[model samples]
Target: MTEDLMLLQEKVTLLRSEGKYKETIEACQHLLEWGMAANDHKSVLVAHLHKIASYYCIGDIEEAFNNIGTYIELCSIYGDELDKLNLNNILFLLYEFNKDFNKAKATLEVSIALGKKLNKYIIISNGYSNYSHIYCAEENYEDALKMAKEGLDTAKLLEPASPILELRVKLNMAKAYIGLENFEASKSLIDEMINDPILDSFIREKSNCYDLQGNWYSKQTLYREAFESYTVAKNLVESYNDVYLLKAIQAERCKLCDLMNDVQLGYLVQKEYIAILNQISNRELELVALRLNIKHSITDIEKKANTDYLTGLFNRKYIEYTANQWLEQASITNDNIVCIAFDIDNFKSINDTYGHLFGDEVIQHVSKSFSKKFGEHDLVGRYGGDEFIIILKNISLSDGKIKAEQIEESFKSIEMMKNGLSISITASIGVSDNSGGSVVTFTDLFQKADVELYKAKLLGKNQISCGS
Candidate 1:
């Protein structure tokens, strides 16, 4: 089985290397299924990572974003600290590519925080470089230069050193300098980049240097030189068949065309540019439809996971999770937090007197009636077969009692003919509040409400009992 998984992974790698992105995605799906069946979480995580890469390579950033959630979940469980740092780095770059600069910065912060914790100076340095890149994207040149300076200093702390990484940082710093109109400083860096043997080894980097040269020339009113520089960059990008770089180079040409006011030149290049841009737009639109479908599927899965099968209300586990969050947040505000518990009166008798199916109808009917009386902010959950719990925030205890009483009354008034079976129901209610820390946690508050519910049952079946 392990051998089979390894061979499958190799196939995925080969397919991706061949630019068979769609096949690669399909193979990754099988890999996930196989790994999950064997409980091999590491392989599962690897599959998710590869799938994300495939999606990103195909320019499906939305799918990449969706898959990141599950990857983070698996990574947290099975991946190491270095794995986490890499995840942060990948997430930062992913967000950056998606043009979500704020989220990119946020992910970089996570990378930096983890790097600091692990004393991994390389991660910190790369993190600073990413910050510079993000700032440059936002046209915040001063901050970009600051981050680039920091990246440079941090790179020095690396024991062995990464010349390539340092080179990339310098490129970013140079771009920042260009943005700030420091043409001389930019020219110095650009000249160094053009002369560097390392850039010779990297076609994309070399192309980018030429692109920057065009920018420098254009900004200095050197249109003829800028046009030549852009041509060189475009030819290099075309040689590499880099869609992203080609698009950027073409955009620069578009601006140049307008500035030069050369109608013939503009028409000659812009047809291809428009075609590529339209391809991207069409691809994005198709993905938008796919994204909506995926989103619906995800929502259905979440609903099944979190809601009770019988009544379509949140189950015990989800309620516990959500209630705990509310309890944690309650300290931020002194607003009254109420926990209401209730059980259908004589539920066992109802099930025995009628059929269990009819009893189900009763439960569903009561749930609908009970939930509809409360606002969306109220948390409603089926705590047990016949019991329900709700949490309401920013409401007075007296208001909570009134709401509970209303729900009890609502159950008394509703009749349901589910599957041609008729039933009427009422519930005994209990109410408790953390107005002054009478209960400190969700469990404590729910138990207090349960006690009040017991009192309501002792006094009479269909009634509300408030904590006294």
Candidate 2:
């Protein structure tokens, strides 16, 4: 039965990869039924994950959001570490699509932190690539460049890198360069992607590349070249049948037509846009039916999911949301937003030596101290296990570092006793802030804090590391 389920799930994945979202949704119905009958939590989670993505791909963002709440609850209750990580990753895309850039950045930050803990390099690379895409959408091209370069650098570290995903990252880089008005750099990258054989195999992505090529040409007022590029893109989408991409290409073409006052081009875009929108409307009706058929019979899973019930602190999701708000406010006010990460040193050893109950006690003990010392801050939360994160608003880096040191010193008294043996708990601390004056999101700041946390672990533990 397990083997059958795995094979069926693989089929669904392949179909989705091939852009057969309708088929993917159809397959998910069977998969979800089988998963529920077998009481397989993970399989049910994946079925919903794919179903939601299929809905989004087919231009039903509202349904995606509707289903996502249940999905997140399932993840919170039954998800493994990796399952929860993937949840954050998808939330990043959903938030991005909704134009909630602050929330998007926060989710990506959580995703990156989880990926690093699990050594999921692909997830980390994807997170950075997504950051670049978000910045590109915001027209903050320099930060987009920074993020894309980081993504590429991380991708290079993979033993056998994902070629197609790498190209997509490069595609984002090209768009960023164009937005920055670096025509020469943009053209060089675009030409490289256009010539890459791997891109030819993915018609939908190739169409996108051409659409971007059209934009590039239009940006420079090269109307003939732009028109030719848009023509190729339109034809490819005709074959690929991605209504969303088709509509977007038409929208771009419409702007180009208006720019040049080309009546023929304007008519062409109007015709294509209406045609694609109609196709989308028809497909959405069908998928909406499938959603009604296959949605899991679950309800009220979203109750207080933002709280870590074990310690009565805000959970990762809420922490990210709150910090993102502060980060946004700081961006406008030119104030600093700082974050600190704390990991209980030798926590596993304590779990092994003293009982699981003692370990729980230690966590509660430390969490209490956090509340007393730093509760009146921007955000405070538990990032699972024996780790906690605190966000300080409108604070300088130096001041934040001092607070971290003070917290570290305070932890000396936070410990539990077992049978006359008294052991004190010490933690490795990492502090990061927006003092660099370049970061536009919480993810940027969190990444630096995470790195500094690693540094503290490397520096013999029980020390404080602050990013410059």
TM-score against truth, every candidate: 0.63, 0.55
Put down candidate 2 lDDT per residue, 1-468, tens digits, no spaces: 788889988988999999887778777767876786688887889888888888887667887788789889898899998878778877877888889999998998898788788887788888888999999988899999999988888777777768887887888889899999999999999998999899768987798799989999998998778978998998999996777877877887887788778998699779878888988898889877755644442211222455788898888876876677777777778878888988999999999999898899998889888667775555888888998888887788899998898788778766567899889899999999887445667677778898999899999999899988
Q: Pick the candidate with the highest TM-score.
A: 1
Which residue ranges in model 1 land beyond 4 Å of their true spot? Answer: 1-121, 124-163, 173-203, 213-229, 235-247, 254-264, 280-302, 325-333, 349-355, 394-399, 414-426, 435-437, 459-464
Score each candidate by Cα lDDT: 0.83, 0.83
Instruction: Report the lDDT tens digits of candidate 1 across residue range 97-129.
Output: 868899989988888888889888888888999
lDDT score, candidate 1: 0.83
Collision pairs in model 1: none
Question: Which residue pairs does candidate 2 place in steric collision?
Answer: none
TM-score of 1: 0.63
Please give the lDDT score at residue 72 for candidate 1.
91
